[model samples]
Target: MKILIADDDPSSILYLQDMLGEWGYEVEVAVDGNAAAEILRRSDGPLLAILDSMMPGMDGIDVCRGIRQSDTERYVYMIILTSRVESEFIVAAMNAGADDFISKPFNDEEMRVRVRAGRRIVELGEQLRRRASRDALTNIYNRGAIIEILEKELSRQGRSQHAVSILFCDVDNFKAINDTHGHLAGDEVLRVLARRMAATLRPYDSFGRYGGEEMLGVFPDCGLEGALEVAERMRAAVAEAPVKTEFGDIDVTVSIGLATVDKDQTCKLATLLQRADDALYRAKANGKNCITIAH
Candidate 1:
């Protein structure tokens, strides 16, 4: 893990850097509050930070406050160093979002223990977030997470004037497969198909399990034609390959419904989703294993 040490005191910075480096952590240093804040603003910034209570321009408290107030999604395990053992100082640090505190004259053993605690907390948070956002069966984004992504992209398009598109995909005859082959075999088919369709999508595209036997794909900066082409490819990929399950090789097909937002139009996420879903139903009505584009 990478750790940031923000302190104005050169001697203290050197001491912590040397010790932290020896302990197998990549160490980064910041001489004052402004530099520290800049580093924390970066997407690839260190997740663990130790800030000195007193620094020029911005103190550790101010830096901590800024981090808590920022739009960052990741959590930073922050520690505040202070010379005073007063209760008010500890309260101030806690209010400013400091995760832990170490006295200015840091103890070697105490530092190790606190740092270990910080790592544990950060890891636990990451694990919980993954569980919440991921679908257990297909290992793709869950329904809630995909819907949230769609909403966010719609909001972004309003500001950037970029086109966005979505594909609502439903597996054809999936219920019949489950009835004939059993639920376990049906699950294997869903997992295999999820991997295959995900491979067909662009790296920037977001693919997720919308619900049972249904998937969703979000394409950013893509128009109607682009989305339709991708959707056709995805349909072909499913039809061409057989999903190998423990029971047997099961041939499956998918129906896709595509909806796109042009640069000039403003669309709500709910409306966009409804259009794609309606198109999906149309595709089913037209016949299984086909693509329908929502105009």
Candidate 2:
């Protein structure tokens, strides 16, 4: 694991680095809290940090608070190390978002135990984040998560001039499958279709479950024609396969609607989603299973 040790004292920094390096951790050192914050802002930070409570300009507590405010992949497991262990000091550290605490003139065994516990917390946080972003049944991105991603992508387009297309899809005759067989059969079909669509799409193309019987896909850097081709391929894949279920083999089909991002559009994500949904309705009305590009 990568570890960051921030202290103004040279001797203390070297001692902690040598101790952690001996324990098989890759260590990086910063002279003060300001330097530590700069290091975190520059590179992807270490999983765990050992910060001295008192330092020059931007103390350890301030640094920790800044990190908590920033949205980054580094889940910093911070251990506030200081000579003072008063109740107020401990409470201050906790409020500043310290994951663990260690007193100066530290015992080696206690430091090791605290660092190990911090690592466990980082692992647990990563697992929880993954679960929150993923669909339970199809293993695709969930509705809430993909909507968040869409907003980010839209913001990026405003700043960087990148183009994106949104495709909304609904499984045709899904309710009929449930009525004829069962909900389990319908679920199996949906799961299988999701997997197949994901496999066929490009790596940058993202697909997600948008609620019951509906899925949404976002293709970054793709225009109307490209999205139409993708929709056609996905439609063919679903029609060609027979989904296996407990009841029997079930045939499934999908209708897709495509919408390209316009340079002059001032609409929000919900408006874009509504347009795709309207196009999807047109696809269903024209035929049970086909692709429709929104005008």
Candidates in order have lDDT scores of 0.91, 0.86
**Per-residue lDDT of 134-237 in model 2, one digit per residue for the tens?**
99999999999888778877876777666778889999989899999989888899899999888889877888999998999988777777888888888898
Q: Measured by TM-score, how close is model 1 to the native structure?
A: 0.82
List where candidate 2 sits over 4 angstroms from the true fold.
1-59, 71-76, 81-92, 103-109, 126-136, 199-206, 219-240, 262-265, 285-289
Candidate number achieving the greatest TM-score relative to the actual structure: 1
lDDT, model 2: 0.86
Which candidate's lDDT is highest?
Answer: 1
Clashing pairs for model 1 are: none
Each model's backbone clash number: 0, 0
- After superposition on all CA atoms, what RMSD does each candidate show versus the true structure? 3.3, 4.5
| lDDT tens digits, residue span 107-144, model 1 | 99899989989988988987898899999999889999
Alpha-carbon shift of residue 170 in model 1 (angstroms): 1.3
Model 1 per-residue lDDT at 205:
87
Q: What is the TM-score of each candidate against the true structure?
A: 0.82, 0.71
